[model samples]
Target: MLVNAIWDFDGTLYDSYPGMMKALAALVTANGGQIEPKTLYRQVKETSIKQFLTGFGQQVGRSVADLEADYHQRARAYLQDIHPYPEALAVLKAIKAQGGHNLLLTHRDRSAWEILAHDQADTLFLGGVDADLKLPRKPAPDAIQYLLRRFQLNPAVTAMIGDRSLDVDAGINADVKTIYFNVDGLNAAPQADYQVDHLIEIPPLFRK
Candidate 1:
């Protein structure tokens, strides 16, 4: 079976959570606040840093704008830590070798292009739609819907893979098959067509 894909960049294809959480913890501490990496990370999983920052500002005694600026600076500083997860590239290449369209949909900003390009994985994608496109964020189907039409893909043969429930929800909203990359096994029962504990477990779910 031929397959087309939409992948989430940050946590699914990459192990960016540790670095990102550490950055958030540092930023919070530098501003005279106290938040552990694990605590903030979980909050972010349910919501975005921007959204989380609204209330986080009050707790940390800073303005939302200031907090956002701090986050942007820290994110750039931590870019080096955002390497591709082991075995992720192999799966993507295997699918591409089989004549699939692998499109990346990430909420990560345009700054990610430099990192991806540096890693030489940017060209592996057919195309990418990210924050630069200014689409509504996940749990909203706008971005996926656009990709489906742009590629003229059949929803049945396409899959959206990501590490969070929002990713699964977006794929569900778009009416495509969803694969949740629950590596930690925390998502005991994600509302996805399939659940994978590793990136290498992905290709078999669709390529067959």
Candidate 2:
């Protein structure tokens, strides 16, 4: 009876971390700070983009905002390489076919929709809240609350799927079930209603 599925963009529906990591690597190099790809990935994955940028800024004698501005500008080139996770579209279509409304909840702005549109996946979503809306970021539940009210989604029948702990935390705060897309095998699991390593495993959870 899961009638609504709220998805996270990067690392969840789309394999965007590679592009984002490349952009960060290039940014670090341009700022005369060296970072290995694996090291950069681990740091960003374990912490977050903002945390990574904060430390990078200090190392390069720049402000976080300045560093982020530069990173976003550089990211555009790399981001074009982004694509959906394997079976991600299939899972989305399955949800839709089962009469479930798929929605996006992400910190990314228009670029997220642009990416989904390129794959024609944008049409599957009922609606979403993006960063441009200026809602409090995930783990806050403000954006998810807005979606619940606007879409008349029942929290009991809504599930939030995301790759990060904050995403699960936001879903919990919003009073919905959470599915943690644990692409990497973390020893300590987030307290999600369900956990899966692949997109193909998702649709079964929502089946009647």
Candidate 3:
């Protein structure tokens, strides 16, 4: 049975991309640049917020820090609209019921806690690593390594569940099982150890 599950917060657990897209759109418009929403979505999903913001800043002759500041402020408004994915909470509950502990590891900053708290999902996590920690981002494995060491978790029976390649890479780097949550049919990371279409399908795999 899986004894420890590390979760990704944004697209993995919460439907946050729409809110994130809104924030990015507002930032681009404020900079007097027009963006194609689908293109922006694809770019962000394939790369990252930092990469996209940095590239956009360079294109529009703005500083990345300035754009990030404005974008984060805009994101706060939309964060309230973000919610847990259908059956996401149920999966977390199931993990806990199986005597496993659920933890969070996300690129989002402390604001991630806000969303979890809002949805009353914060209690499901034993702890987390967020951007506020100033740790290296996904694919680096620094954050996941820290979590494993700090929690005294064994990687063999632990799993990292996420919606992106970086998340799977982090898990691989940390020597843990990787579960790719490909609900969007994106098929982005076929290299993951396991892939699933729905959150409801998860708990059974770890059942004792």
Candidate 4:
């Protein structure tokens, strides 16, 4: 049977941490605050910008909205450098060649999608959900359900590939298979149907 996979944009398909870390450092410094690089990187990975900024603001006595606005303004230029992970495009091509369908399910906004579309013009993405859609984000199952209904995909044959537990939760909620892209085996979550350290490792799992 052909497989349908929903890929997470940030840590799974793209290596967005470098740019995000740079942006966070600049934003915090501009606000007369300081944050360790490692801590900021982890925070960005595990928490939403709004949640991180809300806590950061409470620490430095600034309004969350104001800080988020400033960070987003400063982060625009940083996003320009965002790039896909090595072999990500190749993996996508391999999957498609094997009669698989792919969709992007991310918490990113349209700006992020524009960046990705520019970087990889030929990638086969059925459609994507952005923050502007106002659908609940990852771990909420709303976006996955939308995709399943839109594509008429079988829940058992569809998969969600992501690097976080939220991704697994989303897949479970949507009644789809889940693949954990644990490059370092850092997050040992047992809920994942499969765990892989590299993008290319995915193809074999779908072989009939």
Give residue 179's error in model 3 in angstroms: 0.7
The lDDT per prediction is: 0.82, 0.88, 0.89, 0.80
Ranking by TM-score: 3, 2, 1, 4
Q: Per-residue lDDT tens digits of candidate 4, residues 68-181?
A: 778777767778677888988888877887888878887777876687678773357777677778898678899999999988888988999998778888898988999999
Global Cα RMSD, each model = 2.0, 1.5, 1.3, 2.2
Give one digit per residue, the lDDT tens place, for model 2 in 103-203: 99988889999999999999999999998999998788999999999999999989988988888889999999999988876622369999998888888
Candidate 2 lDDT at 94 equals 95
Model 1 lDDT tens row, 53-155: 8888888678998998888788777788788888978888878877787889998887666767877778878887888889998989999999988878899
- For model 4, the stretches where C-alpha displacement exceeds 4 angstroms are none
Compare candidates 3 and 4 on lDDT and give the better one.
3
Candidate number with the higher TM-score (2 or 4): 2
Which candidate leads the pack in TM-score?
Answer: 3
Clashes of each: 0, 0, 0, 0
Model 2: residues with Cα > 4 Å off, grouped in runs: none
Q: Score residue 177 of candidate 4 by CA lDDT.
A: 92
Model 3 lDDT per residue over 112-164, tens place: 89878887889999999998898988888899899999999999988999988
Report residue 173 deviation for candidate 4 (angstroms).
2.3
Which is superior by TM-score, 1 or 3? 3
Query: What overall lDDT, based on C-alpha atoms, would model 1 receive against the true structure?
Result: 0.82
